[model samples]
Target: MTNRAAGLLLFALISFAAPLQGQQAPAEAAQAAADQLEAATVALEAAESARDRVKALTGTVRAYEAGLGAMREGLRRVARRESQLLTQLKSREDDVAELLGILQTIETSAPPVLMLHPSGPLGAARSAMMVAEVTPGLYARAEALRRDLEEVQTLRLLQQNAAGTLEKGLSGVQEARTALSAAIADRTDLPRRFTENSVRTAILISSTETLTGFASGLAEIAGGAEKITPLSVDISAQRGELDLPVEGLLLRGFEKRDAAGIARPGLLIAARPRALVSTPTAATIRYRGPLLDLGNVVILEPQPDTLFILSGLAEVYGSAGQVIPAGTPVGLMGGSAPQAGAILSLSGEGGGTDRTETLYIEVRMDNSPVDPATWFRIGKGG
Candidate 1:
């Protein structure tokens, strides 16, 4: 290659090196996820008793979900980086081939002939200096290109092996969920604020056509007007500071109309199938059952006059009038969790959030519907 061509190639190679520095981030994220998964595995193994098994298993499931999510993000970044490397390499194909030929010629040429330029002795000396200057750069560039190729191979292998890891993670989470469910069923230590009168509850459900009407009659659903001790926990002081009941994307804001043009005074969240739904604060379960057309519901009274209604659950936990602590698992969202192969396929598609189930949250104060956003601190997926 001519001196100018060699100089241009060196510049391109140096420019390419800068981007390689960014590649480490994805690998670091993958390593962190692997570490998280290992910790979750250890926790799962340590859980032996039914007493704390529910909490342990819940942590395990959350850890696995976080690790799997991180891994998927890392894989996505790896795929993008690999594509960028391939494109860069392809665009410089001719330059690379010329560089290889030049290196080969230099290696095979006689020392005396390599020193002799066709122009003259002065030209030959300058050519010798140029060769000395450019040879090392060419080799260095070739080494960088080799490393890039290796990285592509490494990324491809990582993706291929990820399927197994994801499968194991999926299986682990499912087992944890099953174990948690069994543990919750066997639990009998939680304090009950009052007993739900099934007869009265049924009558209330039959009489009420809307959630507002049903919530208004929750007090009458108890067996009798027992003078129950009020809860000490105050949720009014926690406005705009409570975490969401589940990890999910905020689909529709409060009172945001859907395609059907019907708007409701609630927040709709898009969550992954079978995702854990927990209470954001210590509250009394006013009701826990199917209500109207909103599927299964869990109504929590965190204070005297305030109610937090969570709808769209597939499996409800805790009995009506039970006092549960904050972060206690209340239910699981509907739909089956995606299989490992399906998860891998979805990751490959570069899709947005993989949420398939929806949770509707409504807040009520003194029997009046209010925006849930005023109470929950909603983020990207929480």
Candidate 2:
């Protein structure tokens, strides 16, 4: 199946996989990511300087974070406003309900009219006339109460719609902020690891020879994001000198995986440094933007035959038409908590929901995912 079709197929598979554990509004998420990332950046700045830099940056970062705190507080206040609105509407609803109840009771308990003894009665006609007048007044009151009830329902609907909009916006802000923070943390630590002498690195890849047949639906004439390049693998060790380009916590192997979970990983490097990504080729940047729960997204098509969807990152390096080597930094990991959802999805104390920024990586061979695990040995074992 085509890569797009494959995704659709998987999507059709009930999408019963673990659902993303977040339900935050865009605004809330954004604010949270931004604050955390800014703090990490400040720390990096502090690391780069001597004596007072840390101290100075500590305050600056604190202030920046505090500012975000203030904004969050404002949002809360708005939420509170919504609550107040709800309260107001509730009160009106209660009032209407009470009035309706009284009307209903009266309608059910209305006394039966007594027949007037017109032949021998004294003041009998006048008594019957009085009863008839009272009945009209009761009917009028009940009708008025029903109208009140209807009005209350209309008000409730309007208030509900408004609240939904605000809530969604809040969630978005939260997601965005959290992802931003994770990216900052990744970038800040990059220079340190690359310069560390004790750091280790590795390049795990498969080799191909006599390659042929690589093109796209829009082949023969393409521009903007279609400049093909061949990627060569260098897996040999160099006289005890490690060719790995990173330090600290490398993921040992590519977890081997197949369309049906039928494979295993060749290597799974645990403890990978958060500085950069390992890609095989230099490709064109096709898309770059914020992806709600995924953080910053970058699409690189290395060849007419191959493409990469790199996401779950905070900061992206190298823009469109830029050259990035195998170990080039595409972006910072969205968060380093093993799973992207730990920090991004959490709000303070996990009161509302969980969120994590995940960089969705999908490789396409002419618009189809060719099971990256087969090549990288990522999904082989697990």
Candidate 3:
């Protein structure tokens, strides 16, 4: 390959290499991550508690509805009572008027003048007349009518007080219901989403250690392993300017979880052409789909073994199984400035009983993951 081609090839190879950082996190990033976890946990727990509150509020609302029903009934009763009292007052008024009219007519009529011969019949009539005269009856009826008027006035006042009481209670009940509704709104997103966030965070935490280990071996060749395969590239133009694919910052370095230079997936190398821009890379079609994250992953296949996964460029444009010549675009090299490396057990979360998705590329002597560096060349600019 010409100098330009070699440089371009180097850029592709370096694209997936990670830089190692020792075991501590930057204070700011660590603090921020901690805060986020705290917030997420609180939110999730609150949401769980909300289920109970929601239930309680629902019950309270139902109770209020029942109370409203009874209040409405009471209001109806009060209305009927007022009507009844009014009817009673009106009938009493009519009876009083009738009595007064009878009194007036009686008063207007001339007194019956009986000519007594100063005898026995006169004496008997005088005694009987005192007891039988309509005047006393009229007076008694007038007194009874006055009492009824007073009683009706008193009953009207009582009805007024009862209606007022009912109105006040209803207002209080309505206010309580409105407060309950506001509380329900405040508690709205309490539980389900909270749980999901926790799950996502946990997965991220598990990857932390592996990322550390992979960073340390960056730029170094993998130890000679049986399954690892290294590809060399060269460019005829632009030489050094376009070949190395390190973005900038070091995301994470070697740690407990890193899968570098050890297991079946032993080693991996990925590439992205910086200067070979004119030639549309065939790697784009070679790795596509769920290989999505592989966004241009480096899988070195030896003359003797299955695929050994290394790393991916931030962006990819290929699917697996398609064969192509060298010098392809593969993908873009722009993830972490330096790149991140993580070692996952073959039994990574989604890996299930069988190993899958973990960076621990399965070593397949015939068909399994052995240590990878044994088979391939993993140099700074492979």
Candidate 4:
């Protein structure tokens, strides 16, 4: 190869390999996920005898979900990086072959013959210097190619072995969910603000046509029963700072119109199937069950006049009168969890949406609808 050609080839090789140096490898992300999964497994074991098993199991399930999410992202990145490396190698095929030929010829040629040039000793000396300068670059390029190939192989193996890890994680999360449900059912420690009168609640549900009207009659649902002291938890300072009740993507902002062009004073969150929905703040369940056209609903009273309405749940928990703590699981979003194979395939496909379930959240202050985004932080968790 001419001096110019050698310089250009080395520059191209260096450029191709440069990005790999500073960028974080997929293995680090995958390893972090593995660590998270291991911690969740330990938490799950500890939850069995925990004083508050519901809380313990909830954390365990969330940890598992987070780990699985990270693992999926890591795999997607691995696939993309591998594809990029392959394309770069394929595009430089001719250059690489030429480089190899030049290196081989230089290695095989006797030193005496290499030193003899057509233009005598001066020309020969210059040619020798050029060869010496280019040889190191050629070896470096070869080493870079070798590393890329090894990385591709490693990524493929990681993907292959990921299925078993994913399966275990899915199973573990499901078990934690089941255990959490049982724990919640057995929980009787929560104080009741007032016992719900089923007869009155049913009558109110039948009479109301809109959420506004339904919420207006919420107090009457308790009938003439004596009321216990309300929860002392104050959430005024938490406005615009509370985490979302669920992990999801913000599908629609406050009052954003839907497909039908109807606007509502709430936020729409798109979540994965059967994702856990919890309370962002300590609150009493004002109502819990099917209402209007919405799915299973849980209306919470965080203060005297402020209410948080969460709808579209597949399974609702807690009674209307019970006061639950923050991060308490109230229900689960509808739909079946994706199978392990499906999840792995989706990750490989990359950037495909698996958030099939939607959760509608509304915040009502002084019995008037307000944007939920004002009260809860957006874009974090959900």
Q: Highest lDDT, which number?
A: 4
Candidate 4 structure quality by residue, lDDT tens digits, 205-261 = 999999999998888888686554666767899899888888888889888999999
User: Model 2 over residues 1-382: C-alpha lDDT tens digits?
Assistant: 1233223323323322222233223334445534554554545445445343323433343343333333333334334433544564465565445444544544564354233344435444654464355445544544543443454454344334433333433443344334434444343322110111111101100111211212132222224323334334333222123222111122322445645774422222222223334344434544444433445666555554556665555666544434444434455444442222222222223121222222345556656555444433232110
**Best model number under TM-score:** 4
| C-alpha RMSD by candidate, in order | 2.1, 20.3, 38.3, 2.1
Give the distance in Å from residue 372's predicted Cα in candidate 4 to where it truly belongs: 1.1
Each prediction's whole-model lDDT (CA): 0.81, 0.38, 0.34, 0.84
Off by over 4 Å in 3: 1-68, 88-94, 98-151, 158-167, 182-382
Candidate 1 residue runs with Cα over 4 Å from true position:
1-15, 226-228
Question: Candidate 1, residue 231: CA error in Å?
Answer: 1.1
Of the two candidates 2 and 4, the one with more favorable TM-score, higher being better, is: 4
Candidates 2 and 3 compared: the better one by TM-score is: 2
| Sliding window of 10 residues with minimal summed lDDT for model 1 | 12-21
